[model samples]
Target: MGRPLIHRSPMPGLGLSMGITLTMLSLVVLLPIGALLLKGANYGLAGMWDTVNRPRVWAALYLSFRLSLFAALFN
Candidate 1:
């Protein structure tokens, strides 16, 4: 006969592992993005456009793009 589908095996502590993983994912990944989105929502489209159009922002973006491209090429 085939084995039962939902039988528990030898593994343990899965819930603890999942909880820690989800907590870290929220803190490390989700929180900063949420904060950035909230800040942008408060700033509104016109303010964001003004900030994006500035020379300093353009230079920084260009530098970031170049660095990313360089790293991608090496990879």
Candidate 2:
């Protein structure tokens, strides 16, 4: 016979730890990405492109890039 699918773990509270880890992973990493994907889907590609193409967005991007480069060079 093959090994059982579920076996007892040597470490106590392993299931609880796993549950907490998965919950934190879902909340911290997955939810915001899912929301962004949903919003992007609602907007469609052209709308997303138009939003990104604005002068303000470009200016902010350029400023952030220059600041990041400056900090990186010093660091």
Candidate 3:
């Protein structure tokens, strides 16, 4: 019987891999979040409730819920 081939990665290459992962995360994830951070940081509970319970927002939320319910049943 033949044994399956196992690939071995070098130990020192681990540091390089870690550096690449951290750099990718910091640049790709952290660079473009100023708006999201500001929005979330500025949101108050009363303002959130007011926005959600408004007439237009409530209509859209109701429609989304019904559509998602039907889609889930079939999908």
TM-scores of all models? 0.61, 0.54, 0.44
> Which digits, one per residue and each the tens of the lDDT, describe model 3 over residues 1-67?
8999888776758988999999998888886676555674677777766666889988998999999
Order of models, best TM-score first: 1, 2, 3
lDDT, candidates in the order shown: 0.93, 0.95, 0.81
lDDT of 1 by residue, 1-75 (tens): 997798775668888898999999999999999998899988899988898899999999999999999999999
> Of the pair 1 and 3, which is ahead by TM-score?
1
Best by lDDT: 2
The prediction achieving the highest TM-score against the true structure is 1
How many Å off is the CA of 23 in candidate 3? 14
Q: Candidate 1 clashing pairs?
A: none
Error of 2 at 54 (Å): 0.4
lDDT of 2 by residue, 1-75 (tens): 997798767898989999999999999999999998899888999988998899999999999999999999999
Ranking by lDDT: 2, 1, 3
Q: How does model 2 fare in lDDT?
A: 0.95
After superposition on all CA atoms, how large is the RMSD of candidate 2? 6.1
Q: State each candidate's clash count.
A: 0, 0, 0
Q: Report how far off residue 12 is in candidate 3 (Å).
A: 23
